[model samples]
Target: MEQNLQYFLIPFLNWEMMLLIWVGVFAGIWVGAIPGLSVTMAASLLISFTFSWDINSALALICGVFVGGVYGGSITAILLNIPGAPAAIATGIEGYPLAQRGEAGKAIGLCTTVSVFASFVGIIVLAVAAPVIANFSLKFAPRDFFLLAVMGILLIGSIGGGDPVKGITAGAIGILISMVGMDPSTGEMRYTFGNIYLMAGISFVTAMIGLFGVSEALTQFRQAGLKSPKQNLDRIIPSWATFVKYLPLSIRSSLLGVFIGALPGTGGDVAALLAYDQAKRSVRNPSRPFGTGAYEGIVAPETANKGAIGGAFIPMLTLGIPGDAVTAIIIGALYIHGLKPGPMLMIETPHLFWMIVSCLSISSIALLVLGLISVKPFAKIIEIPKEIIMPVVIILSVIGTYAIQNSVVDIFYMIGFGIIGYFMRLYGYATGPMVLGLILGPMLDANYRRTMQGAEDQFLPFLQGFVTSPISLFLTLAIVFLVFSQTAVYRRWRGIQ
Candidate 1:
């Protein structure tokens, strides 16, 4: 395994792979700076153009963008309320608050430092631990996955920009939308309503584009071209002391990121939120309350979100299960190049796996350098006129979504989601629940069916399994907390007592 891992990571010292990685890095950064464009979208878009490329070169470029774009979303989320990607929502909770307070540059600096560092940790863990954990991860059958997805969806409460109802509502909407496509087991159409387009259901990327892109444009217009702070930022870097303070938390979050990323269906957004919640719980003094411009607020999610990059690859390489949507698409790319990802893949494609591991570490280093240099200038972008900024955000969002499949239908999907997202906000509904639900819905469906099948008509084992797993127990408690948070009695009791 040791010797084989090397073969995969260093298959060839070719210029093409290096160039493709660079291209992905650049494209990811650019795409991530805009609202609605996500790492998944960027990876999917690359799939179209790279049908003929060498497998190693394709992996290098695609993975580079995947890592970069996840980090890049924080750039806009910190500078503007318009999150560049869904995973940046948690960042926006603290980030936009800082931006509103005219500390956009400071927030950007802190986030950049953590993001790069966390990514480095995640990559290191992925490289070192893949062989050990890949098989363990596969132990998660459909039932386990379903329970895991439910646990992940519960995270919606914290991610709702501080509201539970809106998030849950949005999540319900997303689940319903995901249900539009044919039932995987039943082979029946539930929500297509005769349109072939609806048969494919609502893609999360399009919904995200609408929720972040269109809603943000309307929001900017509401500001009526309001002037923002004139950021005179230079030497915008986080202090070493700050990095030292977050080192422990960063490591913990990176671990969480890796595990969550390794899980099928869930991704960076979930990892970031989970890390943020853990940070809130673990920090006794907190330096300052989170969401109040605390450095911890910036570091926690930044680290976890980027750490998810490595976590996401673990399952993809060894188990042939795409950890998330982006990896799923990349899996397709791998097969297109005559490579398969599975248990046998380790024996047949060992070199491919190591190359990916190596690329992850290299990318993290690159992000650190690029992130430090770019964060200040990116934050300064808030100074652009709302009229100009809003329109550009919309255009980029449309292009980014459309770029994924070159489909005008996706642009329309984004528009629809935008309108829905605007109303959700107006009505005090959170988009967080919706996004989380959308992400977890398919996982939930697949796993639920599998668990039922495994039970052989007995429900007790299914219930027993839910109660037995350590991860499941912790997740169940989390779900309980989420549901309790929404209770009128809970709100009133707290208010009065």
Candidate 2:
């Protein structure tokens, strides 16, 4: 215990490490607030610059970026209705409305308070329950992952603003688009159409930039006369009563976030969306109607996404499996530093695990202080003229898309997606489901194919695996329950309708 305490205290005692974490958090806020410049991108960039640094300092910076970036995404979502990251999509549903009503300060303040609380929730879970969750996750089969992807696809109902059919259409289109490149497992061209660039497949980041960032820019052009919302900055921190009012919901949503974040190929985006849906269904006496400006809405998603920060680290530290793209990059950093990250990683290098837990805890604390301090400046950005900001936003989108692979083709593709997203939004189709489909499509396809191969391409055997494997059976049942919960009868039973 004393040795573990030493590992945890190392970062707190090192001024250089502490400074890097604070700097990373500050930089991450700006980066994440800019659409298309995602947490994954920031962490990847850190790797290039920090490769020669000691592993501990590098990790401290990355941890700060991870925590701060996740929270920073909400800043734009609340202020401009454009989600800086997919995880913030649900935040915008309520947050942007609050901003429009000139309550951006209160909304953001509450979000920060709950987010910090949830980050601690995730850290505690990581410290206490990580090994158990890691072992349990290891039991998940390929079929189970495929099932999980299917469950994620069903979340279109939650994210889609209206018209389930249109949502399904958009989501299906996204899934199809995800198949545009060569097949990874079979090494065969899919929808590549003989284009060399197509063979590498589309970067989802580029699509996200187009769909959420540039598309939002184009949509704003149509609302030319609309002025940006004025913010109330006097009371940017929540009162104890306000925090207490939402404590229960924060706890529930945050725990859900931690679990979802620990899932491989899943991350804060899914967790936030799920938490939002759960809050919408569960909160009976909301401060306001959900779509307009409900505090419950912001609390659920912000807390969930923040909680996912610690959750993402659990699998990375224990099982070598990345919980999300940011963690995947962190895995590469570990490898570059001559460290293996599998089950033996913790047993052989116990200090690394404890140190990560410590760093994430410190990062969360930094996020609260830095996040609150930036609220006024961030809120002010919302007041910028659309004519000036929109063009800059588009340029940022172009740059962010290009940075993914330094490809000009991706910029064109991003522009094309932006155009499509604009038209779709005009036609009442929400972009959220489509992005969800794109994110989960590859995971679904790869896992399904692997499971099928394991079953020797026999249909019956593939189905049987769901019943044969305990983990697969549990997931299958959960999927069934999820489907059932969507029915009118179930809603009626829960008194939701």
Name the top lDDT candidate: 2
- Residues 158-182 of candidate 2 have per-residue lDDT tens digits of 7777688899899998899899899
Question: Candidate 1 on 370-474: residue-level lDDT in tens?
Answer: 777776667768887777777777888788778767789888888888888887777778666776677678778777887888777588987777778776666
- Residue range with the least summed lDDT across 10 consecutive positions in model 2: 133-142
User: Per-candidate TM vs. native?
Assistant: 0.86, 0.95
lDDT for 420 (candidate 1): 82
Q: What is the lDDT of candidate 1?
A: 0.75
Worst 10 residues of 1 by lDDT: 4-13
Residue pairs with colliding backbones in model 2 are none
For each candidate in the order shown, give its overall lDDT on alpha carbons: 0.75, 0.88
